[model samples]
Target chain A: MGKVKIKKKSTFIDMTAMSDVTVLLLTFFMLTSTFLQKEPTIVYTPSSVSEEKVPVSNLVTILISSADKGKVPEGKDATEAEGKIFISFSGGMDSTQVAPVIRGKMLDEALKVYNAQAKDSKKIALTDAQKKVFQETNMLGTSFEYLPELLSKSLTEIDKEQGDMYNPNTGIPIDGNKDKNGHLNDFQIWCRAIYTVSKELHDNMATDMGLTVDEAKTLGDLYNAITKDGTGIAIKADKDTPFTTVETVFDNLQTMSLNKFSLMTALTSEEEAAPAKH
Target chain B: MAEVQEHDSGKKKKGAQKKMTIRVDFTPMVDMNMLLITFFMLCTTMIKSQTLQLTLPTNEKVQKEQQNQAKKSEALTLILDTEYTDNNLPKTDEATGKTVHNVYWFAGLPDTTFQTNLLAKESFMGDTKENGVKVQQGIRKILREQNKDVMTNYDELKAQWKNREISKETFDSLAKKNAADSTLTRPVVIIKPGPNTTYEALINALDEMQINQIARYSIQLPTHTDTLLLENYQQRTGETVIRPTVRKSVVY
Candidate 1:
C-alpha cells in the first residue's frame, strides 16, 4: 500500500462579529453626538472664582467687548485690532443708549398680530376718524401705526448719523431694515439659526423611534424646562474683560430676571483657600 | 504486523472524527465597555442653560434737592464734549486762553470758561499766574473741601441716623458716602468731556480716576423726565424735607 502523505490545513476565521461591533459603535455615535449650532460671536467675559453653572436654554447671549478708543492706525480694521467691546444687550442691542430697541421690536410684532386679527374679524374699512374711535374703544386696539412710523424714521436718522460718524463700509447699523415679520432681520436670523441647530439635533435623536417635527419639540424646551426649574445658566468669559462691563452685564441679567446664572471658569486641581487679588 | 494493523483499524473505526468548533465569550468585553461609558458619563461636567434678565430704571421723577440744600451736596459737574483730550482734560489754548474743544454740555457749548473757573477754584490756595499751577491748586483745594464736607456730613448723619430724623442733611451725607464708596469700589473718574469726546478720552479719565482712588463715579446725564414737584418746591421754598410723597401731575 502506498504511504499517504499528511498535509497541513490552514484555519479560516470569520469577521462577521467584528463587523457588527464596528457598525454598532458608528450608530451609537451618530445617535448620541451633539452638533454646535452657531459660530460663537466673540464676547469678553471677566474672570470669576464662582462655580455656578450657566443654563443652556433660552440663553440670550450678549457680547460685551471693551469699547474701541478711537480710529485705528493705518492698515488695521478697528473691530479686529482695537480691543474695544461695548456691553451689548442681547435682543435690545445697546441697553445703555438705545434701550427702546427691544421694546420697539416687541411692540411691532404685537401690532402685526393685532392688525392681522382685526382685518380678519372686522372685515370693514373705516374712515380715519372711525379708526381713531375704534382704537380708543377696543381692548387690543392700542394703535401702533404712529409708533412703527416713528421707530422707522428714528432708525433711519440713526443710520444716517452712524454713517456720518464712522466709515460706512466698516460700521454696520444694528437695525438696518425691518423684516416682513416686523422684527430686526439680523436678530430674527440669529434666533432662527439657534432654533434650527437645536431642532436638527433633537429630530435626529427622535428619528430612530419614527418621531415627526410636530411630535418632537426643539431642544430649547428641554433646556428651558430644566433651567426654569431652578437650574442655573453658566457663563464663561475671557480674563481680559473689564470688571465694569461684567458688572453691567450682570446687572442687565438681573434686571431681566435671569438671576440664576453662574460664571464658568477653569477648574483648579485643588480648591484654593482664597481668590487671588489683581 | 497483521495483529498491529487489525488493532489500528479497530481504533480508527471506534468513533468518527468530529469537526472542531470555536466559541468567543462577549460578556467580559461588553462589561468593560459599559464600565468605560459609565465612567465618562460620570466624569463629564454638565453645562447649564441661562438667559439674562434686566429691569431698567424707569423714567421717574427722582427729586433734585433745593438750591440751598444742594449746597450741602456740591455737584462737581464735569461736562464732556467730543473734543476731550487723551487725558480727558479739556484742551485749552495757552495763547488765546480759549478752549478749542467742543462738548455736549449744552448742545456743543464751549466749556473752556467752566473748566478754567473750576480748575482755578479747585487748585488755587493762593493767587497763581501759571495755568498748570492754578489747575493743580484748584483740584487739591476742591478735594480737601470735599473730604471735610463729607466727614462733617457723615458725623451729622450718624447722629441723625441714631435719632431717626432722616433730614436733608442725612441725605446729603448719604450721597457723599455713596459717591466715596463707589469711587473706592470702581475706578471711575468724572471728566466733563465735550460731546465729541473720543472713547479714548473717557477711558483715560477712568484710568486717572482709578489711579487717584476715585474709580467709582458716574457722568451726569441730563434729566429727560418731568421735573419733580418736590425738587421745584425745595428750590423755591428753601426747605428740606426728608421724604417726598409720590403724586402724578398733569402733563399740560
Candidate 2:
C-alpha cells in the first residue's frame, strides 16, 4: 500500500463562489442602509415598548435639552437650567462641517418655493431678500429680528456650545409668548415653514397625479398628517427636564393650532413598571 | 498570485505548443469581500428610533356647552408630581438614581374646604420583580382596574381572532373601536403633570395610559375642582406635591 500511494495533489481550492456571495451582500447593505443622524446633543430618551418608527419624510423635529448634565457656574443659581432648543427637518442635508450654511440654504430654497406659490393665501409671507437672512443658517436659536446676524455671523463661535446644546442662548426663542396680533413666534414660524413646504410638496405630488387642491388635503394635510403619521412634531426633551418646560413648548405649539405631535423614546426590554406608591 | 501550468495532452499537433491553464487563487478577493461586509454591517443602523403618538386637544376657548358637560361616574383624575425629600424639593430614587415620581390620584373630588382626610398618594416605583411574577403594587393597579373593561374586550377580540372566528383586520378595528367608545363604562383618565414632574414621569404616565388601553384619556391642566382637592390634600398629608402655577391666562 505504501509503495502504491506515491502521488501528491496541490491544496489549492477556488474561493470565487464565496467572494461572489460576500460581495453581493456588501452591495445590498450599502444600497439599503440608512445612516443615523448626528444629533447636536446626545440624549437618552425615556424607555418604552412603543415600536412605531419615526417617519422618514415631512418631519419637523424640535430638539430640546434642559439641565443637560450641565455644570453650574460658581455662585450662579443651580436650579435655573441654561436649556436650549432647535428645529431640525427630516430632509437634513448633514454636511456637519457646514451645517448652518447648508441648512440655511435649504431653508432659503424651501421658503422661495413656498412664498412664490402663496400669492393668494391670507397667512403672512416671507421674502427671499428679507432684512434678516434666515436662509444661510445653522441650528437657529434666534428671533426674526436677529436672524440676519444669526445667518451671517461666523458659525465657529456659535457652534462652540452646539456640543452642549444646553447653552441657554442658542435655543430658538420659544418663551410661550404670542405676538399681540396672534402670530407664532420665530420657533413656530420655522415649524410653519417646514409644514408649508411639506404642503407644497404634497400638492405638487397630487397635481402630478391629476388631483385637485381639495383632494390634496385628504392625501397630506401637513398639519394633521404630521400629527397622524410619523410623529408630525417630535418633542425630544432631556429625561430630567422639568415638565413646565415641556408644557411651555406644548403651549407654544397649541398657540400655532398645531395640537398634534409625538414624543421620541428609547426602546427598552424591561417589562412595564410603574411608580410603586400604591 | 496566479500561475500558468502546462497541460501535457497525450495528442499533440505539429508545431503546436502545449496548452497552458491559468489558475487564479481568489483567497485575497474573498478576504477583501469579507472585510467590506464587516465594515458595512458595523456602519449600518438597522433599527430606527420609535415614536409614540400624542394628540393635544385644541387650546381654543371652552364653550358654555362644553363646560356644561356632566362628569361621568368613572372619571378618574391622576395628578403627576415629584416627591420631595427633607429640603421640600424633588428627590431621586436611591436605587435607580432617577427622580422619585409620585401620583396624587382620586376617583373624584377630595374634601377641599375645611377638609381633614389625607389625600391619597402613591409613588411610581415599578422596579420590583419577584420570582418572575410582577407585583402590581401602585396606582397602576387602580388604573388597570379602571381600564379593565377595554382589556376584557381586547382579550375577547384576541381570543376570537385566534379561534379564526374573526379576521385579523376586523379584530383589530373592533378592538380599538370598543376601547375608544366613550359611551362604554370604561374609566376616563385625566392626566395633569405638575410643574415639578419630570418629562420621563409624564412619558411614563402616558405609557401607563397606553398600557391600560384607555381611550377616553386627555392631558389637561388641573381643573378648579382638582385644584381645590390638591390644596386640601397638601395641607392634610404634608406630601411634597409641587403646586404648579396654574397659568390663569391659558385655558385647557
Candidate 3:
C-alpha cells in the first residue's frame, strides 16, 4: 500500500473581513446609542397602543418602586417596599437652564416651599456642601427631613441606603397631606418646586433667550413642557403595581393642580379582532 | 488582502535591493472593536419607552350644576380588577403568559335594582379570527358596539391612510375630529378601577377606549353602588370576586 503525503498548510485565518464588519457595527452603535439612565429601582412599565414618544428633554420622571418579589428579609412584608417614589429631572440640552442649574434651583425652591409650611422645629436647612451634593444627584427620593443627612453621605453609601427599601427614610413621603395652600407632603413639595421653577425659567426666556412666549412655546421649552402640553411630567411605574399605589401619586398631582401628565409604557401593536366561536 | 507585498523583477541586477512583504495582523483591531461593541450594547437602551398621555380632571370638586351628565342610553362603565396568586403575585394566564385582568362592565347608570344584566364579567381576551374575518371579543366587543358610528368613520379613515389616499397627519387630525364628532352617537365611558386592579388592567381599559374611538371617558373610584353590583354578580355566578386587598398601599 502506497501512503500519500498531505501537504502542510499554515493554520492562520484572515481577520481583515471580520475587522471590517466589527468596525462598521461599532460605528453604528456609537452613533445610535443613548446611555441608560441610572435608576435606583427597576420597573417594567406597562405596554400600550399609544404611539406618542417620550420627550427627550425638559422632563420630570416620577419612578414608583414595585413590590419586592425577589429576596425578602425574614419577617418583612414584600409590599412594604412598594410605592417608593423617586424624582429625576432632565433639562433641555441646548438651553441655558441645564439639568444641574435646574436641579439647584429646584432644591432652593423646594426648601422654600417646605419651610414655608413646616414648623420652626421641622424646618430643613442644608449646608452649602449638601446643596452642592443635591445638585449632582440624578434621582432623589428622600424626604426633606432626611435630605441633609442623605446628601452628606458618600456616593456609594447614598446608593446603598436608597436601594434599601425597608429604610423608612428612603422614599419621598406621599402620605395624605393634601391641602395645597397648607401643609404639603414631600412629594407635593417637589411637584410645586418643579412647577414654580419651570414657570420662572419660562418667563425669563423672553429676556434671557430673546424669545417671545409664543416662540418659547414653539420651542417646547421646560415652561411649555410642564404647563401647556403636559408631556413634561412622566409617571414610570411597574405594570404589576396596585392601582391604589398609583392613585396616591395621581391624587397628589391632582391636589397640586398638575392634572395633565403622561404614563410611561412600552409599545404594543393593536390586537386583531376576535373570531366568533361556533 | 491584509499584506503589503513587494514584487521583485525576475532579472537580477547588480546592487538590487531585496523585496520584503509587510503583513498586518488585524486580530487585535478586531478584538478591540468587539470589546467596544459589547460595551455599547450593554450601556445603551435601544427601545425608547413610549408614553400614554393622560389628563385627569382637577381634584377640586366641581359644582353639581356645572357637571355635564351623559345620556343614560349612551353610558358604559368598566370596573377593573386583577387576579392574584396565593403568594400575592399577579396571576398569569397559562395559555398566553399574560397577567389575568378581570373587568366588570355595566351600561348606563348602575342598575342598583338588578333588573337587568347589571354587571357582566369579562377578561381582556383581545381578539380572534374566524373564516378570515376579524371580530371583537370580551369588553372590547361591547365598547365597540356602543361607539359604532365613531369606529365606522375611524376604520374608513384608516383604510384611506393604508391606501395612501391621505397623509398620516391628515388622517390623524381627521380621525381625532371624527372621534369627537358631537353628531355621532357615541358612548360616554366611565372607568372605575377597583382597589385590587393592577395598573396594567387600567391601561388596557384606556387602550380599549382609544381603540373603540370613544371620545368622552372619565376615570373614577368605584362607588358603593358599584360594589353592590359586583357582589350581586359574584353571588349569581358563584365566582369569588371581592377579595381583601392583596397589596396594602403605604398611604396613611
Question: Which candidate leads in TM-score?
Answer: 3
Best-to-worst ranking by lDDT: 3, 2, 1
Residue-level lDDT of model 1, residues A142-215, one tens digit each, is 12333232223333443343222223322211222223244322222323333343334345546855767566
lDDT score, residue A17, model 2?
Answer: 78
- Model 1, which residues run further than 4 Å from truth? A1-35, A42-45, A49-52, A64-74, A77-237, A242-278, B1-18, B22-45, B48-61, B65-252
Q: Model 3: per-residue lDDT, tens digit, A190-216?
A: 999999998888778767779875776
lDDT of candidate model 2 versus the reference = 0.64
| Best-fitting candidate, scored by lDDT | 3
Best-fitting candidate, scored by DockQ: 3
* lDDT (tens digit, per residue) of candidate 2 on B71-150: 65677778887665554344777876667777888774344554433357876645357998655557767777777877
TM-score of the second chain in candidate 3: 0.92
Expressed as tens digits, the lDDT of each residue in B1-252 for candidate 1 is 101112223335557554434445444565555565555444443433222221223223336662122221333433432222344332444644323322211112223334322221111122244755422232323333444434444556657777778866666557555547633322222344332333323333333232233423453332311123223434555643212211111111
lDDT of model 3 at position A28: 97
**Candidate 3 lDDT, B85-204, residue by residue in tens:** 999998887766788888898887877789984888887767677898777889988988899999998999999999999999999999999999999899999999998888888888
TM-score for model 2? Answer: 0.73
Model 2, span A43-78: residue lDDT tens: 556766566787765466787765534565666543
TM-score of each: 0.27, 0.73, 0.94
